[model samples]
Target: MATAAGFEGTLAALPEAKRELARLMLAARQPVPAHPAPRSGAGPVPPTALQARLWRRERTHPAVATGSHALRLTGPLDTRRLRDALTGVLRRHEALRTRLTGSTAGRPLLEVDEEPVLRFTEADLSGFTPQAAAARTALQITESASTVLDLESGRTSAFRLLRTAPDEHVLILASHLAVFDGWSSGVFLADLAAGYREGTGHLPPPELQFPDYAAWQHRWLDGPDGSAELACRRAVFASDPRARRAAGGFERGHLPVRLARGPVARGLELGAAEGATPFMTLLAALGVVLARREGRTAVVIGTPAAGRFAGALEGAVGQFTTVVPIRLDLTGGPTFRELLHRTRAAVADALGHQRLPVDVLFSDGTPPPYDVLFALHNYPAVPLDLPGIEVGQLPGPPARHLELYSPDPAAALACVGLVERDGEIGGTAEYNRHAAAPEDVRGLLTGIEEVLDRAHTAPASPLTPRH
Candidate 1:
């Protein structure tokens, strides 16, 4: 087992300034203790803190937290085999069979069904004209994507197979965000394909299911390490301003932005030169932009982290994404390089203590300190490769939801999701229109781009905030 000396030795390689910064920031926190081992049982377990939060939000907005994907498969397809594969996948992951039970002391609990029931639906539009069939298929996809799941009834996911032609088909997979996360989609697709190509019996059972993780998480939270982590997080956010300045209704607006390969490559090179990753570079730029807009030295932004730190969690299909708040203090005017370093340290500290759930961290029923969310998705890209069929993802409707995991539009003033694909960085900025005007959001994006360009071209130059 690794000791604190080992951790210190690893930190010794970093620059003196960064090492000192990390040491100071993490000095008060205690080392994480071993969590209780997960045991298999059929009893009701307390939902994870994040899941409980989503469950509360679901009371007002039905299906607002649903995540869906549409895929167009063209070629010889086996409908019966696909249905059986779906059933097999459902049986393999307990999250698909989970339901919300009665509240225990104002917190919702989860119960997993012993037998998995596949909620599969099929529609045939092969008799209609080609164009008409396509339109009908699209409509069905949209409906399935928006349909609300009866969480109390243990119906959390819905699947539909639309046969547009004798050789073409559309598959829709939708599930509640409480049980399913972005990472789970890839796992589901990979398992489905495997079950389709081979037999379900050939697939080995997962070492631990989602419920096991949930139960273990609860036990861990009530332990010594969990309490220390929660206290450490509270201290970090204690200095944050409590004023809810941004006033916004629940309506959302979206603006798409793209940077060509040239700039993205240059930005990556700049980050590499500074011993920073792409996310650190972007986060530093975003901090400068927010500081300029808000006219404050302190900046707080929320970013999601994949919570699957344990190797046992890598294959589990469940909600393992946790949002962490990265707070930066730009007290003195610093160059982009300096800001990047600060961001690197802050991100390291935040991620080091990321196991503390957001709901428990901010359980006062008041809004969180940050109003902006910055996400750089680097999820594993698992292709939907079947035996002989051509699989391609079909674009769905524009997402107006501001929050990434929940349907609550007022969760953030502006949410920026960036993805680097095909040598370019492109993403959408979903903002609450009632709080920020479209032009303002557009200008914010423009400022981020300019900051990145400056950092790439001249990283040593000071980050001058526009008044």
Candidate 2:
């Protein structure tokens, strides 16, 4: 436990290069130019059938479109076979070749082509090292979408083919969060596998294409008579002064620092079947840690929720996520277990309040003084497969950076991003470099882990100190 405490200090003391990385990521978060005549309202705009038919319209930020082709034949890989398969995969996902342009209204727009922007390459894998090939492959999977500044969007997805010492071949598919949601990963993998099999002639038919989902989305978002839910959401939004804030206006700049990535130092998980949903468990854990660190009875953390909770927008998959600020107050009234109950209630209330765009929520003469932001991604359960190969699903990692500042005028602030994948829950803490030592950051995560483990069994005991 004492050693775990030291781990926190180590994180706080990450090298300057790590800090620069954090800064770059932070800069990436600045607001982009607003779209001209952007959809008005807290709710997302509905796309028309014509809009849905366009590949660019369906592609969204936080999800990248990438392509990869691999050959694992009985003999030497047929470059011809690999190239053909790659072309087919690229064609299937039109977004791969799509580009974005700013509308006259300043809104972001998408453009698609039957051909791709970057041409495909077939490297000599038999001679090249795997790591070298992986890195090379990462570079070739170019961006179909970019920010207004022309900086590559901070998202990534990939198609990789590996020859396991001859005779055997494997394809690995992955995408970063910027262009794809966790839910969509499964959909993509499964389809890629099906598509690959069909391309290779092993499968009888390709399952439903993405167009099916787009068609469904257009029908649902557009009112039965042909109008879109956009007008309704817009009406509600226009009436609410808070709805007009900039979409990505949370913070101006970041200081990127890579803490030493060691074994989780400490972590735990809540089973999916426990009837205790992840949201509730996560909130409870967050509340306990923040309360202990700040020595305050209550702490507020911002959570991102899909604002498109209405069934009407189920098929609409743009950037519909909203930020919800949850306050956990543990003043003298309740014990850990009791406070957890309060935490659950607070989370529920905040979800309902999520209708307000963060721009509005923070727009008052004053910004809400919350120091931490935690988002839960319980992506729906789905199957995943890549062409000729089966892809295994693992709980995806959460955002590594936590931008922390004291929400209180009197206190300094620290941020921690807590995420759970598969059943394991762990967090990365971000503290003000000026106010926090590398050791202190490590201590925070260590303390949280101890609190969680001990709390699960001994919920009544005071949290044990690690460092």
Candidate 3:
């Protein structure tokens, strides 16, 4: 059997900062997986459409790390135990330990490492006041997110544990979108808690790894480009005025959308009925809001579809969410119930025809195909059941694939993300700094909630909100 002393060479070679963790590693005698996975999984790592787009951006701005999830955790101090838990979690999930490499084929590929290279950075904020420490905590988060996760160099995830005082700490968990998605974040927390409680070797390996999903997606998308399956795609979206592709592409007369300032975030909570499906009513409300904002009876907005259409992928952590266009018409001022009925039907069609990647669906569209995108976080509220450590989600800014848009309105969409958590529905309205004003998004967010409330009360009447 392998012993802790056997790991001393590996741990000693680590930077001096991780030396304390070295002690923890030796003392705990945490066993590695009884069945260590192969150094690399079979087949080429499937390049997800979302990753393709994000990778393109990363090639230019390697520092543009997007997903920084932090927790405002306060509890007893057990540094050694926590370090073991972190490594244990990394060892459990292949997705968390996988790296990305861009090939001349112009797509980023994945490589699963035999073991996780954990980098845990710690800071003692003992001297600073609570207020100053809070400021410094924000700076640390920014610094943690400043550098992109370079997979070719063999890294994708990072940890920042700051001790504000003896029993309190701020934990910032981060990962690049290349492999991590919003749902994957929750999965990581659940797995972290599990690995912390039980030995890493005890946990069952995932029935399906992310690479499996990637390979499946590759074969699914590699089929004929034009098929009868997508016949309904173009027809269902015919309600939009811009459905007809103009000759010579989009008209040059369109003006660039400008944000009055850099993107700012706003939050709101509106009641939702338990009977209503996750995003059906919420997205229906957004459709109504967009129509009101543009003064157009016909509106088109993009919403995310979890793409976990398969049972095998429910627990896997990866980039499986994709966006699809949903068109709604408020013509003749239909009743709220009537609008929802229409919204449900349109959304159902979108979901049914969403097999094509979002990028592929809109790559050929003129004027970028959509002006606004909505993400209803139908996320599982997985709690971190760590002993003595009260781990809660750090909800800030917003989480959405909206960043994929270009700065020009003619090319990108304004993205808004919403979630219903703990009996309250709230989230951030994120707009591009160059295309749309933050203040406009704030007003739009408020207006959206108002419409949602009105819909809940008066589903039979036209959706014209009373001031």
- What would the per-residue lDDT of candidate 2 be over residues 360-423, giving only the tens digit for each residue? 3343344444645555556555553333433332222222222111222112234554456544
User: Model 3, residue 211: displacement in angstroms?
Assistant: 1.1
Reference-based lDDT, each prediction: 0.77, 0.42, 0.63
Worst 10 residues of 3 by lDDT: 259-268
Query: lDDT per residue, candidate 1, 1-467, as tens digits?
Result: 98878878867888865664455345325343353235433556778877776677767877766778899999999999998889998889988899988853665678888888888888889999999998887787677667887567888998989988899999998888778887888888999999999968856757777777777777667768788888888888888875354455567677887755665577677777889898888888788888888888878888888888777777889988877889987878888778878989999988876677776777776667788788888888898878789999987655433554332346567878888877788888787777777787777767767787777788777766664
**TM-score against truth, every candidate:** 0.88, 0.53, 0.76
**Which sequence of candidate numbers ranks them by lDDT, best first?**
1, 3, 2
Q: Model 3 misses residue 434 by how many Å?
A: 3.1
Error of 3 at 376 (Å): 2.9
